[model samples]
Target: MTVMNADEIRKLLPHRWPFLLLDRVIELKPGVSGVGIKNVTISEPFFEGHFPTESIMPGVLIVEALAQMTAVVYCTGALQAMREAEQEVAATAEAQLEPAEEIDISSRVGYLVAIRDMKFMKPVVPGDQLLLKVKIGRSVGILSKVNVAAYVGKVCVVEGTLSVSQRP
Candidate 1:
């Protein structure tokens, strides 16, 4: 149950400031599911124009945040699988040597190919802590189907399924 901060998340994802939405990944299960957080603030650039009088976080950005969280889960799972494979090889050879360096997975970030049954029940505003959760429902080759949802406390803010295709 390793936790990933912004720095570690950046290593696995290519998104930068003003774009990268994940604030912290609280829990991750390799090749399965993950839970994360996004702290919304009034300072966000989108809030400026999204509504001059009444600010609300855009629904699209919320979906994008879920995608980023999916990247964390997906890439971390791959990295873990790689390391385990390396360990197996090392054991078989009985080599008195350290495992190789961690693979650079920065470019492994995938593209969001699809979103299905998306729903937004409430608006996200400043001072809200958006909780993001995602589960990999199915994976075939380099493509995956992810079930995603976001919440503010116990209230569901958004729910949907997204398809991701890993970068080769």
Candidate 2:
């Protein structure tokens, strides 16, 4: 089990503020599954245009959040596998990467190529804490499908399946 804070997430993801939807990754199992948190607040920039009075969080953004969470799981798993392979090569070779050299995971990209059966069950509002969960379903080469769901206080706000393709 690997838990990633915002900083660690930043090191792995290229998304920045306003677009970086995930606040924290509570539980992660690399490519298998992960659970992430996104604390919605009135201060969110999107709320300004999404709805002035209602302050409803957009459904598309929610899906984007879920996708970002999925990326974390997918990328971390890939990073771990590469690291393990590096260790194996080091065992046979006397020279390896310098002490300061490390993998630059932020360059990785995951594209959301498809969204299926997505339903926005409830309108998300400010002050709500979203619980984002994703599990890898199937994969063919660099393309992978994921089961995604989002909840707020145990109420399912969104659920769907997303197909993502990775880019080097």
Candidate 3:
């Protein structure tokens, strides 16, 4: 299992501060599965608007955290996809998480294909550590399904299925 620090994550993803929801990847198994952690802090800028007096981590951000980890899983399969495409573009491409990594951000977009049965069992607040675990469900063509669950210790705070379709 390869553990990814913030710097390593920067090399593999295109998210930045405020938007980069995950802190580090604790466990990774390439194409199979992965676990990531997001440390929620009172200093996060979003708290200003999310709630002034009693700030709470937004559900959207929690989902994005899962998506980011899922992206890692998606990237692990990128090389294989390139081979199947009989394309050499990815060969010279260096991995980086900056938004600029994608050649056409406007034209080629990563679409949120679907989200099913999302259940928020508890709330995640500042000082809480969100443990996100993602498992590959199935992939067909350019779409991949991932099962995601976020927990704080033994309590499951959120769980859902996220589907992302790659524009080909």
Give the count of colliding residue pairs in each prediction.
Answer: 0, 0, 2
C-alpha lDDT values of all predictions: 0.91, 0.91, 0.80
Off by over 4 Å in 2: 94-100
RMSD of each: 1.8, 1.8, 6.2
Error of 3 at 74 (Å): 1.2
Q: Whose lDDT is higher: candidate 2's or candidate 3's?
A: 2
Model 1, residue 83: distance off in Å is: 0.3
What is the Cα-based TM-score of model 1? Answer: 0.93
- For candidate 2, write residues 46-149 as lDDT tens digits: 98888877899999999999999999998998888888888877777868666636767777867899999999999999899999999999899989999999
TM-scores of all candidate predictions against the true structure: 0.93, 0.93, 0.80
How well does candidate 2 match the true structure, expressed as C-alpha RMSD?
1.8
Relative to the unseen true structure, what is the C-alpha lDDT of residue 48 in candidate 1, on a scale of 0 to 100?
A: 88
Q: By TM-score, is 1 or 3 better?
A: 1
lDDT of 3 by residue, 1-168 (tens): 449888877767778886988788998876668999999999999999889888899998899999888877667556445454543443446444234243322233356789998898887899999999999888898888889999999899999999988767
lDDT by residue for model 1 over 1-168, one digit each (tens)?
Answer: 339888888878889999999989998997799999999999999998999999999999999999999999888888899889888888899888765776778777789889999999999999999999999988888888999999999999999999999886
